[model samples]
Target: MSVPKPIEFRGSALDDLRAFPLAARREAGHQIDRVQHGQEPDDWKPMATVGQGVKEIRIRDAAGAFRVIYVAKFADAVYVLHCFKKKTEKTSKADLDLAAKRYRDLVKELAQ
Candidate 1:
């Protein structure tokens, strides 16, 4: 079997994911693991506005809702662009902007 791709957290994504409640954190980890193994997360949607190949993984727990924005199209690794708690039905502009910035930065860095 092929090895799973490594995960590379961009910006403060890892720390933000860690800030999730225990259950939510674990669930996020599991969903990310699916991405690493070349499978889709249990709950996710395309984040085309963020960038090509970007996707958002959704997690809901007793604490509230959470999200993990990542891009796994590159062969080397899965790039997690951002992580945060969802505060409303609509995703905050701050979150989208951050993820887009990270995605752009990742692309620029990889091109070097």
Candidate 2:
């Protein structure tokens, strides 16, 4: 079998990750690594059908719950579309919209 791709973070996603506390950020990093190696962590969850091909890595700790949204398309890369601390039981529309937009942009970019 082929090897899995490495994870690449978008600007906004990187910024969101940096905003998380140290422990949370470390946890998120570990989960991303798992994805990079083609191993889905237990906390991973698929997003809605509207955001097809996207999955969120759930990170819950004493601090709070955080999410990292990403899509693995090409054999060489996993694109991180969004990262944020979830404030409610469900993801906010704004966040989903942003991720969708970014996902589109990335697809377009790769097409060229």
Task: Return the TM-score for each candidate structure.
Answer: 0.98, 0.89
Each candidate structure's count of clashing pairs: 0, 0
User: Candidate 2 on 24-49: residue-level lDDT in tens?
Assistant: 99998888878888888669878764
Where is model 1 more than 4 Å wrong at Cα?
Answer: none
Global local distance difference test of model 1: 0.96
Error of 2 at 49 (Å): 4.0
Q: After superposition, how far is residue 28 of candidate 2 from its true place, in Å?
A: 0.5
Off by over 4 Å in 2: 1-4
Which one wins on lDDT? 1
lDDT of each prediction vs. the true structure?
A: 0.96, 0.85
